[model samples]
Target: MGEGIPMTNSTDVRQADAAHGREMDPRLFREVMGGFASGIVVVAGMVADEPVGLTCQSFTSLSMDPPLIAFCPALSSVTWRRIRPTGAFCVNVLAAEQRDVSGLFGQRRDDKFEQVPWRRGVSGAPLLDGAAAHIECEIAEIHPGGDHEIVVGRVVALTGDAERMPLLYHRGRYGVLAP
Candidate 1:
């Protein structure tokens, strides 16, 4: 029931059949979406006494009544593979000073936690130190997205520091809030 309207200079609307039924190029889609600024977070979990985590940009609070949050993980993420079986995860909301932490978790490496400082949360997931905040959760639901999985988590704990500035990403670069 949704179709694009003609661009009559009234507002910026493109036709649904733009480029004659050809799908949007992946590169262009990525470039367009990169214009959107997003906060960075690390979704961490414990696996056999080992900590596993991955950087996620797509995370949001889903509900207030039930206290739910959601994060998207790529289909091929090895960290997600390990986290899914644990039944619990912690979201470490990165502070502006944690760009190095985000870069570490965003990669594929066996010693991801070698230099990281963390402690176990009630959910058994590693809670990164120096984060702006932390949300401890238990897995509640899993849904499929085009190239990622939508993981819904039921919030079990919440903690934050208002003085810390959040780390943000936009156009392939890290940013901080304006003063």
Candidate 2:
């Protein structure tokens, strides 16, 4: 969260701007965005000693030298606001069998991590026990996109077990990497 950001109604101006209407139909936009295959990831952080996570497929690496990455969390996503203030978060790249794990984190229900197990990472965020890969990050910047925020993070730690294939997202469903 940034200073003086009117959290009360983040969508006020965007709705007014929408009087001009969408440049692309939302159905088309969904199809296009879905066409771009992405690895599934669970983004988690502790907010007031409680762990919260959300499944995200909109993550991308922004820079390598400075070790930065970004993920788009929809402004309407309640999970995002709850976790963003924690200052640090962990990105757990899922393995092929983790679609259920993704769904668990993606839901609005409470205590998503109750059945899953995790441990603290160097950044003090939860490192999901069996992710194919994990990256710990500190919030670097926040840029508001039309309906989402581009959260930029500076990588502070990384760990992985390279043998596992990443969980994949395509065409509105989860898939496994082809061998």
Candidate 3:
């Protein structure tokens, strides 16, 4: 576990900012945010009949009444643009033992799915073979966020294994929850 951040008043924050001669450091902001553990997922889709995906840690369930979920993709992600036009995607919740798959999808490579075995979902998105869970969704809304886009998806299909542990990311490394 990571250490908790000390509570700071607005005045103290302002003083620290003044001392640093900057509003907030991007590196510090990322490091602080990384302290929070997040489940690792691969947001994948078929673009022109080719499998496209990217490792993402910014995934979460937004609503249950309407079956909504969301994930953030970086502004500069090429894979995101490819998947965006597909109108649907699959959120593949990676299993804890699939860190290598996550690392492969995270990179810019011609064949990310060369070794990844997957099948098409009902939404036409690639459903990874060993994912802890799979959420097929149609693109519902997209909102512009700083340095990333908040992509909301309306769940159309879902499947999972309760016994499978999910892969996690925290403080710039991968981890798995204890049973």
Per-residue lDDT over 56-160 for candidate 2, one digit per residue giving the tens place of the 0 to 100 score: 999999998999999999999998898888899999999998888998988898878888989988988888887999999999999999899999999999999
Tens-digit lDDT string for candidate 1 (1-179): 88853334422222233456755556656766787899999999999989999999999999998999999999999899998988999999999999999999999998988878999988888999999999999999999998999999999998999999999999999999997
Question: Candidate 2, which ten residues in sequence have the lowest lDDT sum?
Answer: 5-14
Off by over 4 Å in 3: 1-4, 7-22
lDDT assessment of candidate 2: 0.87
Backbone clash count for every predicted candidate, in the order shown:
0, 0, 0
Candidate 1 displacement at residue 5 in angstroms = 15
Better of 1 and 3 by lDDT: 3
Query: Which window of ten consecutive residues has the lowest lDDT sum in model 1?
Result: 8-17
- Of 2 and 3, the candidate ahead on lDDT is 3
Candidate 2: list runs displaced more than 4 Å: 1-22
Ranking by lDDT: 3, 1, 2
Writing each residue's lDDT as its tens digit, candidate 3 over 1-179 gives: 99956645864575489588877766667766898999999999998899999999999999998999999999999999999988999999999999999999999997988889999999989999999999999999999998999999999999999989999999999999988
86: Cα error in model 1, Å: 0.8
C-alpha positional error of residue 34 in candidate 3 after TM-score superposition, expressed in Å: 0.8
Candidate 1 ranges beyond 4 A from true positions: 1-21
C-alpha lDDT (0 to 100) for residue 85 of candidate 1: 88
